[model samples]
Target: MLKTIFPAALILCLSAPVLRAQDLPDYVGSGQCAACHEAESQSWQGSHHQLAWTEPTADTVVADFDGTRFQNDDLTVAFSKDAAGYHAQITESDGTTTMRRVHSVAGIEPLQQYLFETEPGRLQSFDVVWDSEEKRWYHLYPDQSLPVGDGLHWAGPYKNWNARCAECHATGYEKNYDPATRSYASTQAEIGVGCEACHGPGSAHIDWAETGKPVEIPGVDAFGLTMRSTADSEGWIQQCAGCHSRREAFGDGNPVPGTPYHDAYRLMMLTPDLYFPDGQIREEVYVYGSFLQSKMYANGVSCMNCHNPHTAQLVAEGNAVCTQCHSEAGNTEFPSLPIADYDTPEHHFHEPGSEGAQCKNCHMPTQTYMGVDARADHSFRIPRPDLTPITGAPDACTNCHQDQTPEWAAQQIEAWYPDSDKRGPHFGTVFAQSAVDPAGALPDLLKIAGDEGQSDIARATAMYLMGAAADQQTARATAPLLRDDSPLLRAAAIRPQRAAPPQEQFQNLLDLLSDPIRLVRLSAAPDLLRAPVASLPPRIAERFGRVAGEWQRSLGNRLDFPETHLVLGGTALTMRNTPAAIGAFREAVTQDPQLLDAWVMLVRLEASVNGAEAANAVVEEALQANPGQPDLMAMQRELQQ
Candidate 1:
């Protein structure tokens, strides 16, 4: 949703840097690099990186923005030419200053960014992104209806790059926006993610090359020329992960490429906002967070391993890319007998050339985010048709055939994969059904929790669902995962046993009190309080008290905007902070009143504290927001009964 643009004079008009006899870093822009590295540059130029941000000139702008007026709701938005460049006049539902300058255009066919000058040299993200293929301008946050003058409206502070986007989009960018002075000064080494971004700063490397002197560079080859990502040298991989991850930036962009990931960006742990009860992509957690949870990343695979960094092309053609790792004779280290005729109807049960046969169409399914941009999940998961009916996640079959049901997909899968026992049951399916039929799935969920063969994500999911199961066996099964290296897995482990021995649970949660993941640390907070205070380690109890105090200080801060509050709230509840838990639920409702969990939690909180009358009012408001939600209707029936 972040849109970036360098000053036109600063971008297209800048003189190309002179390359000396010494091979300088590929600063000649991707075009000049294309001369010798033709194949690589060609692929790079066609990639999302090359087109990340572009000018809307006739040569670059593929969409029909020329005098086009797209109407939405009661508004008429028209893009036309001006002396400065292109401009748009949006006449909204209520009449106001209907014109704004279009400082930059984001993309071509798929999505277009409209830029607004917030301050001198400061451009912010706009909620309205034009989908050229669809030929419409839809809201980026389609779930919420913004008031005309609200800050979250198309023109708002939350969407601005100074706070939200500068770190990722531009190279060596600094976000130095001072609220008190109402002044701003930020710098980018080059607009868009330039060569130096992944390569690290070229000053030292360029100097070493010119002088013909040896220099040390962290996570680089001996020649100081290339990045190294041998399992032993994954430090460089963390550099690429900075922008690619779903994480929070620490300090003011001080951490450079060689800096450890934990030092610069705190990776997000699995939360319900960015994922379902099962670890499937929900909101845009970016690639790194979800990808790290994959068997691929854990087994030494990397982003550049599949994607050609220079050209941005797949290493091999289409499904062939997958064959390198998942071959007939699988890689010796992680062996699995490849199923025969995987490319044919015998395996996929679809026509050979159809999209259904594509490996990514099933495993790396696309989640259309930012309205127009469809980000394919990099997590290579087996398609789970059974989860489709319970959770609203799109199954591979229904994704292709929208009119078909999950039952239809399940039937088709059974027809081809006749031996259903070959494929394992889905964690998503088990968790979804547990919300309704806890008794039936409780034993299976416990088995999944302790199944070392299952994915860590699947195991974590099993642990989380077992909280509602309220069984001693499930609690015992999940205890070991609290020590998991992945904070996501650890956070999930905390959920199942809130009512257990306070001393053991408190000691276990205490060790992770300072966990690098925000969600993990957040989760530990409520559990510390829920435990008998005396049972907690004195140091951990103090830390929990401090974190709670900080949460109180930032009481008005809405976790809902980040879309990770559901997970954060769950963590807070586990720790036993009713006010923070209530606030989180309140923010969720404020953002989207139709969220049934928010209503249900709010009602539960009210019933636990104030009484049934207060709980009923919250439920009434939720019903008004979403009249047809069966879950809310069921909750209402339970309360009355």
Candidate 2:
């Protein structure tokens, strides 16, 4: 029954509008939660989660709507409010004016961004943001130029709320995306991240509450409607990280709060694009990715330890937050851990009231995103003044003392902790070096991967980076990790298998097809499917078909994005389904006209079927939209020859 229901539910998620919480569903809405836990509900009222997504109204909308003009280069966006609703006239680079209706708002305080419904069930976050504190409008990416037709454009698939932003912002969001129509009827239990979003669906709990029944067993502390785990378990952390971490959802739909993270999404490691090689926040990755790397996490520090789950505010202000666990007395739960005097000048090397005196100032630091939004690095670590000079990652010492040099900070650090273990050469130095020169860093990364002392994440990242220079030596080194205890490590190890022959790959990925982790099994599906299934044993072929179907469904769930279509096209090409490949490529270009590779592939496929004239016309149309695009130009030149 469960197996039959799961696939039927998937079809329902694909075709139907989402079921409301009130419709006898497990999710009974935050209002129901407020009836019993008013204190928690009230504390969460105006928190960031509550305001993550709010209906656009005179009260909710923070941006100026009184004919305010924000100019970026030649393009001008004029924001105004009227009886119809808040609207904006956006003039494009190529002298085209578009009227965008303000559908909803995202964020508050530091900055508020408006969302425009560019297409049905698709919300595009406006490029311009309102600086609520400064009382001014500014371009979110003032330094970067994203042209009108590009995928990164405000109207493009990258900014679509249905595919990218909605799940995190809303409660019980069902991204009802139709692969057939490329539309969404996406619905949520509540507009914002409500109580049910964390505590799980409430109907069952409410039933037990009214009847005075036991919601917990002798050892288990699970609520009747909550996830099937207790506070003591890692269930809550996994739930929070579902949205908080930088991850890729496999279109599993809205998950129950207690669902294992690997079952729903593929957690991204400390990749170079998102994090500095030294593991400081480089991009706007929210928080959980870095938090996973912290010693606090290693010592059982969950989000609730520092933050109020209700208000989402720090449990204490200033250094007091750090002092909770980092004091000489230390936390009773973690007595074996070393403690420090974080607030004093001896520890911080600054006056008590100075910015450098703060624990986070030296350790967490910050990176600014959305112009005014500054997020702290959650990977709490000791101030690496030692690595600043080596890796060029910002040290807390140099950040506050802008006048002082990194060498001076290093001198002062060495003077205090002359025999400090922290003063030694770090793996981050190796990680940073690899990003710039993979050939030089591969040997060092291999050493990091083999070392048992290093954290699993660090070792996993090392194995991942080997893809840059996946030579025979690197492949040999990574082969051992294919059977590592950590699934994250095994996933990295499988990267080198791309260099092997089809028969070898079939054998290599066969065991992984039945791996416990969904991430490993699905990742292996495409590779195993690359070889002809007829060549394999009947049972193995059956497993391949089942896994491949699930994998393709996951891809189809994200069909609103052109990149997913590109993946589908590649998969179709492997199976020699030329029509399917052409259709997938066509869908890719339809969603994102400036998707260069999709157009090139479409042209190549079209040339084989409809001759060069048809392919030339396709290239000509693409060239008109994206003038002087090097890849498309090269394709056109090749076709002419």
Best by lDDT: 2
How do the residues 454-553 of candidate 2 rate in per-residue lDDT, one tens digit apiece?
A: 7777888887786758676676667777888877788777776676565665677788878888788877877665654355556866676566667666
Model 1 C-alpha RMSD to native: 10.1
Candidate 1 residue lDDT tens string, 580-618: 678667766665555667778888998898888788787
Winning model by TM-score: 2
TM-score of each: 0.69, 0.90
Task: RMSD for all candidates, in order, please.
Answer: 10.1, 4.3
Q: What's model 2's TM-score?
A: 0.90
For candidate 1, list the clashing residue pairs, or say none.
Answer: 43-311, 44-311, 106-113, 526-574, 526-575, 526-576, 527-574, 527-575
